[model samples]
Target chain A: MTEKAESPAARTSFFYLAIILVTLILSVIALSLGVTALQGGDASAGSYALVGFIGLALSAYMLLQTQRRPSRVTFEMPQVITTILCQKCGFKNIRDFQRGDYVFKEAEPCPKCNEKMMIASIYREVKEKEKERLS
Target chain B: MMLFVAFIFYGQRIQMYIMIREVESRLARLKFIRDEGRKMAISTIKEIGKPQEDPTERVDRFLEYIAIAPESMDPAGVVWKLEHVLDVRDIRFKDEVRLMAPEADEAQLNNLENTLEAALALNIIYKVIRHFYLLGKKTLSLYIIMQLQMVLPLIMREAEAFASALKAFATGQPIGDGAGALVAAKLMHGHEKRRIAQDIVVATVPLEGRTAHVLKSEGPGGNVGKPGDGIRRIIEETEGKIAAIVMVDAALKLEGEKPGDVAEGVGVAIGGPGIDQFKIEESVLKYKIPVNAVIVKEDIGDAVSPMRKEIFDAADTVIQRIKRLILERTKAGDSVIIAGIGNTIGIGQ
Candidate 1:
């Protein structure tokens, strides 16, 4: 199966970088060409300066647009409740706990056939602790 | 940010669904095997009754009728079925010697062997009976006993052998068959009143198709980043992921609390990287997938004495506690990731 991929961060970065590179290349070419034209008495020296100026303006616009968009976005993690369900009879049994707490406790048996239901782990978040510092 | 959060949530749910399916499949397979074993056990027994004649002769004949190599049974299912049978009261690796070859008389040795074997058979029967009441599980073995209410001597014989072995070992002499018989007889005398199956579960996790590094580092607390991120990376790298692991190395009681002793609610977590907790918790918070941990509690030293009922009872209590934990946290359709974290040398690493 083909998965559709879209990276806003990458796309935005790409556009911003392209504008800067184009401006830099244009400015260099304009300066060299202007100098050569002045020395050779070419009449297009004024147009070269204008082209360089426009390039500089475009570069500034790209930088401003990039800054306007937030560099990073924060997402609130979802609150999940881990509940137990019997695979044999599909009996639903909910647990109000995180992962490790169930290592040494007895859950109620499957109400249907009264089979010993092997607890598939409860993958619910209790509460979030602040992110850890590497140091 | 919303899209990113959605991606994480979606990934986590899919993973949880897959995990839940795996556990359900395993449980189903084991249950079927257990049912088959129960049938086999019943078929092997010619008749269930109390013998008044040469008890030894009857016991031997009975064992010959029911004795099937442990290997013949379902490999995975047998352990859970016979878990309560060969109760390893206390296994002392130090100064422990096996029976290499003894120069005892053939009749005496055979008698001793028969006695121990009888005891073992009794243990299986007793366990099968008690398991029903304790776990409320209905197997053919339990149903047979409940309908007839017959007391079998095989269980007593087994306990007597262990007791005799303990006495002989105390005097620092080679264990004789007569001493073994005495132990079996003594073990048979006790009317055990309480049950301990309430707390333990035979928990299994799949680590197949995952990278060695990710699998190796897949412990409770070693991940450096937020546990969610660490696990995500590990799972992504090792596509064949089933559970997130958290390991705890605590000093356990081989022989646990007194039979009626209520547990003092103790601390669950101690020193560790805390990464396993963080990532799993975050993932749960993000997507609602549950992570389960498998804990094995063993005694520190000879602190667990076979002679002491309290110590022996503690092992049962710990086992029960682990089972309870698993049951309480699991659901039918829910996927749970369990990490059996410990140095599994005795049980196999």
Candidate 2:
């Protein structure tokens, strides 16, 4: 019988739980200190306890937000394009490239001239603006 | 006094807990990445094992494999292995091209093979780096992620340049990186042009009172002709009479530097596997030659992608700088070699 490995999310959730526990304990200690300071008539000590309590509460809120959020990673893949031009009619067409396609190879016959269409260029679309600006 | 001490203790405890949670989150992210990398490696190996029925299909299969393959092996050993794989792929591509077009001449076939190899190599290197980069990101390795991020723009630019280079080779169009060759062609116009070696061209251009040997990679194919070989041969041919050797090439600009900025320096300015730079250095040392380097600066994003308008415009400035260096460093009636070092894809002579 093999034991299953814990996912990163699950592991992170456990850490978050631990953080919440610690924060709760700290908050309780701060509130109890504030109550004892008030009973002893020491306002300055009570204020310090209030500060500690607020700090822990803020920390707890941040930890809870992080725990509730999902981690996402995003990336973009660049596009590769092939351009074909007709030698006789000067007609041009752009299409996605197939593997093993080299430059200057003859493609299907030109529709207008009935002449061979050649792979004039095989280039990647590097610029995003070119797509919007040219089209 | 009691309440004050308790408050301080709780405050410290809360801070410690926060730090602990942060570290735990980072470690978890790293583990996630390691798991993802392992999965990708397994998938890639399985893809490589699939059988192809035809030569073209085999080429496609190999090309696709290289394009998506993850870099799971040790970094130190991967470079040599990648080079060998690229070499084998080049030979296979050449053989396939020959079979497809039996009528193509030796020169044409050689050009095609060189262009294809450079393009494929560029693509494979980019993919491999990206694979590791993704792994780093997944693993939540801040150091690895940061380092890869800094160089990612440069790598992407190189990939785009190589792609354009392939198009230039296919269509016989001049590309931007061929600024060196273009400058050489302009200076040596109407002069006796000679082919010193494979993919290297040389011609004599007369300056104000001296003669300079204008050397560049053979263009307008996807070629970064052997500038080191061209320089060494010219030095030998002139019997060490060469007064100075000036190299011009595109360089990656620092974050604050403007694109197309020209800077001058000493020694070889060529970039790559350091093979060509090493050759140039050896020859220069042997003859005790004064070497000058002129670099046109561009952002990493612009350097390897298709030549931008600014980079193209900077060529005039680069030419001026090269001429200025030669005039300043060497005297009249002396012989010099001006070598333009880069992939001469589109920009023509």
Best by lDDT: 2
Error of 2 at B287 (Å): 2.1
Chain A TM value for model 2: 0.62
Query: Per-residue lDDT for B199-303 in model 2, tens only?
Result: 788888888677899887765445676677788899889988989988888887776666667788998988866647867898989989999888887655454
Clashes within 3 Å, all models in order: 42, 9
Question: What are the models' TM-scores?
Answer: 0.19, 0.53
TM-score, predicted candidate 1 vs. hidden true structure:
0.19
Local distance difference test values of all predictions, in order: 0.33, 0.61
Model 1 bad stretches (over 4 Å): A1-54, A62-67, A78-83, A86-118, A124-135, B1-339, B342-349
